[model samples]
Target: MSEIGITCTGAAVVNAIFNATGRRVRDLPITLHKLL
Candidate 1:
């Protein structure tokens, strides 16, 4: 269902952010401060 897509998409975004910045964000509503 849509849930699966949402989960996968979020995971991909998180992974990308981690790869680019070497940070792991384990929360929702990722904000700029969370990366710093």
Candidate 2:
């Protein structure tokens, strides 16, 4: 049960990281694309 809890917490952290990285990446290209 403790291991499962740790695994779930790790998964949540990874998901949050992915979401933040994705948001930053998605925002970056629009201005460059517009300029180009």
**Model 2 lDDT, residue 36, Cα:** 37
Worst 10 residues of 1 by lDDT: 2-11
Backbone clashes in model 2, listed as residue pairs: none
**lDDT (Cα, tens digit) per residue for candidate 2, span 1-36:** 798897677556555655765533223223434333
TM-score of each: 0.79, 0.44
In the range 1-36, model 1's lDDT, one tens digit per residue, is 988898799889999999999999999779999999
Task: TM-score for candidate 2, please give it.
Answer: 0.44
Q: Model 2 Cα displacement at 11 (Å)?
A: 0.7
Off by over 4 Å in 1: 1-3
Candidate 1 Cα lDDT to native: 0.91
Task: Check candidate 1 and list the clashing pairs.
Answer: none
The local distance difference test score of each candidate is 0.91, 0.50
